[model samples]
Target: MKKYVEIAIVLIAWFALILQLIILKDSLANYFSYFTILSNLLVAISLTPKLLASATSFGKRFSLPKTKSAIALYIFIVGLVYNLVLRGIWEPKGWQLVADNLLHVVVPLAYFSYWVVFVNKISLVWKDMISWTYFPLVYLAYSLIRGYFVNWYPYPFLDVNKFGYQQVLINTFFVVLAFISIGLAMIYYNKLMTRNR
Candidate 1:
């Protein structure tokens, strides 16, 4: 049953992503620049092995509790930040609406549900929250550098041209802080679940 749900999530994520890519076919680089796309891609890629239950080294590594938890954290952030900051900025229509909701809403909720129910929580630790910071920080650096050359940003919070560097830095700081805070909360929830179990 868990495998089935994981497979469903992987399919939904890919479908949404493909739909998005087709919509943005002319500006593929801009399409990939969004953290939402990258995070959903990670969810689809990381969980894909669950369908096969493979014994390969890559499968085993991705199957680890840490890897699962990190992907969950990222996808959760995608949903969180999107709903809170970007949801109302523009209205999507037609196939774009389907792609938007699936990528931003369905995939995040489904993946997080899978994590809470199936991923092992006993092995998670407080320091894992700190380790989770690496991906977002690296992504932030990448976005800023890429935005420098491309003259566009995926989200307004990270848009230096609009907000200027200082404001963008402050925004980045808060965004990273949100990521860490949510990570700590996830660790707490994991420990709490473990204790109650």
Candidate 2:
């Protein structure tokens, strides 16, 4: 029963993502919003066992990550601070921006929390990391092709035409660095927690 529910959530999320991608076609904002939600949803599904176990008597047996969850929590906190302090100062009434940023922070934190508390198993490997990297790379390429055809970019950091190829390349480099750093940290943290148990 639980497995079915989990599978259903995963399938529904992917279905929505695919539908949005096909329907939105040229709308960068729509594509990105759906993609982000889909990624978070997939992560949540992958970590659901940890989330459920954490609520039961076997919670302590799961041996969830301390450091990784701490980092994810901090990221959520920083995002909130950025929205309240920086974004608020720039545009006090930017409700849409606030909402969007909040969702971005919340979804990832929720996924991280579930991973640390309920899912004690970590099956990630080099192949998984490569697969994760591939999605972003492919998405970036697709975004570039779409931008070329439609003359618009989804996110400011990815807007090559506005920022130029060199700047976009620099931004991509930083993005990849950030991804690798965070991913390695999480992997190490998970391994440490599991070993200590």
Candidate 3:
């Protein structure tokens, strides 16, 4: 049952990404700029190995509890930020709409569920929570740098051209704060669950 659920998640996530890739093929660079796409890509990549019932190194590595937890944190933020901050900023239509919801809503929830139910939480620690921030920090830096060169920001709050440096930095600080807050909560949950078990 877990394998089937994971397979479904992998298929759905990849389907949404591929649909968006097909629709936005002309501006492939811009399409991949969004954190939504990248985070969903991570989820799909991390979860894909579950479908392969072989004892491969890639599968074992990604199957690590910390790896799934980190990816879960990323996709969770993608859903929260999109719905809370980015939703209604622009309306997507047709297949793009389907892709939008899948990336921002369905995939996040599904992957988090998979992590909560299937991932081993006994090894999670405060350090793991801190380490999880690396991906988002790197992504933020890459987005800001690329946007400076390309004059295109994936999300409005991070748009330095419009919000300027000070505001963007503040916004980024809050986003990181939110990430930390959730990471702490996740770590706490891990401890609690493991203790009970």
Candidate 4:
């Protein structure tokens, strides 16, 4: 049941993302403009192995790094932050509205559920949480560099051009704090879950 649910969510995420691409057309020339897409795509694709594991021996062997769990947590944060901070700004309509909710709301819930209910337990540590920062750090550098070149920023908080480096950096600091907090919770939650089991 969980496997089927994951497969369905992954399909919905990908299909909606593709539809968004068609709708936005030229606007998404730089696909990385939205972290929602990057995180959702990564988490959805990463989940394919687990979703397929019930059927294929190859999927069974598709062992992934435990650190991928951090990506799952991060993607959940993406959805959380978007709905909390950015959703009202978009005011989407029709299919845009549908796609927005699926990508930024439904997909995250689905992936997090898969993680909690289906994924095998892996030992987690503070070091694993530290490793999670690397991806977000690299993404920040990439977004800043790309923004400098293209004069576009993905999120208002990170728009160095408008907010300038200092303000953007401050915003980034808070975001990093949020990431670390959630990462710690994830590590501890995994430990507790294992203990209870």
Candidate 5:
């Protein structure tokens, strides 16, 4: 059942992403544009550990377990922020609406559910929480650099041209803080679970 659900999420994400690009039409012209959006990057990020867990033992290697939980928490943040802060901006219709929800809502829930239902409770530590922050920071650095060159921001809060670097940096700082909070909470939860056992 877990494996099947993982497969479903991967399929659904790809299906929605392709359909969304098709619907956008104009955005399709810029190839690099596709990877810039956080939603696309997140679904792909969320997919990695799921795929790793089921098909191979790679997820347990190269600090992949740390990365997995971190990405899961990040995607959770993505969905939460979208639903709470950003949902009103897009007036998607029909299939676009479906795809929008799938990407923004469904995938995030599925990934979280996968973590709760499928992931073994590892005894987590402070190092795990610290390790979780690396990828997001790199992503932030990359996004800022690219935004400077291309004037294309994936999220409005991160748009330096419009919001300016100060505002965007502030937003990014909060996001990083939130990531740390979530990572700590995840570790705490795992620790509690281990204690119970």
Candidate 6:
């Protein structure tokens, strides 16, 4: 029952996000889509077996690692730098770009931090990697298709029209690499934590 509730929270959050994007299809280009994507990704990762196990007594039965939290923190930091500092989107005084970025990027990163650092207790593994990676991969594909018809993309990283297909693909490759690295780091972290405890 509790597991169902936890899963429900994740699903509901993602559903609400999708509904918002559908309704605001026009304005979704700005930054809302980015936020939705990131938020949903975080939620999905949180519901993964390794992370969920940490919250259960059974999680202690296995020799979990400690690298999950560190990786999550690293991802959050990189995301912060990418969206806020390097992108120059955190200027709260200007065109509300900062606010938009904060809602879409900052908030979700914060959630990831909380989940990885304080909530998750289980060790991650290859299976956990597959599960955690699925959501973002699907979301990225959906966003690309949607961007084609809508003539709008949620983030600059995915703006193929502007960057050209080759560039977009290259950037996407890098993004995938980053995600994979982070995922592996998270798995290691979780294992370390479990062993230490």
Q: Rate the local accuracy (lDDT) of all candidates.
A: 0.89, 0.52, 0.89, 0.77, 0.71, 0.56
Instruction: Give the TM-score (vs. native) of candidate 3.
Output: 0.96
Candidate 1's clash total is: 0
lDDT score at residue 120, model 2, on the 0-100 scale: 41
All candidates in order of lDDT, best leading: 3, 1, 4, 5, 6, 2
In the range 28-86, model 3's lDDT, one tens digit per residue, is 88887788898999988887875774378888888889988999999999999999988
Candidate 1 structure, TM-score to reference = 0.96
Q: Write the residue-wise lDDT of candidate 2 on 1-197 in tens digits.
A: 44554444444434444544454435555456333543544444443444466565444333334423433433443344345444544442354444344445544455455455654446544333444455556766777777778777756767787899899889768766656666666667767876797
Candidate 4 Cα misplacement greater than 4 A, ranges:
49-68
Per model, how many backbone clashes are there? 0, 3, 0, 0, 0, 19
TM-score of 2: 0.59
Ranking by TM-score: 1, 3, 4, 5, 2, 6
Query: Could you list the CA RMSD of all candidates, in the order they appear?
Result: 1.2, 8.5, 1.3, 2.6, 3.3, 7.6
- The better-scoring model by TM-score among 5 and 6 is 5
For residues 1-197, what per-residue lDDT tens digits would candidate 4 score against the true structure? 86677678779878878877777744665765678888877776666766666356644443354645776777888887897888777688888888888888888887777777766646666788777888787887888888899898888888887888999999989888888898888888888988887
Candidate 3 residue runs with Cα over 4 Å from true position: none
lDDT of 6 at 19: 49
lDDT of 4 at 109: 87
Put down candidate 1 lDDT per residue, 22-114, tens digits, no spaces: 887448778877889999999988877756655877778889898899999999999999999999999999998999999999999999999
Worst 10 residues of 5 by lDDT: 28-37
Question: Candidate 3: how large is its RMSD?
Answer: 1.3
Residue-by-residue lDDT tens digits, candidate 6, 45-66:
5555433666565444321333
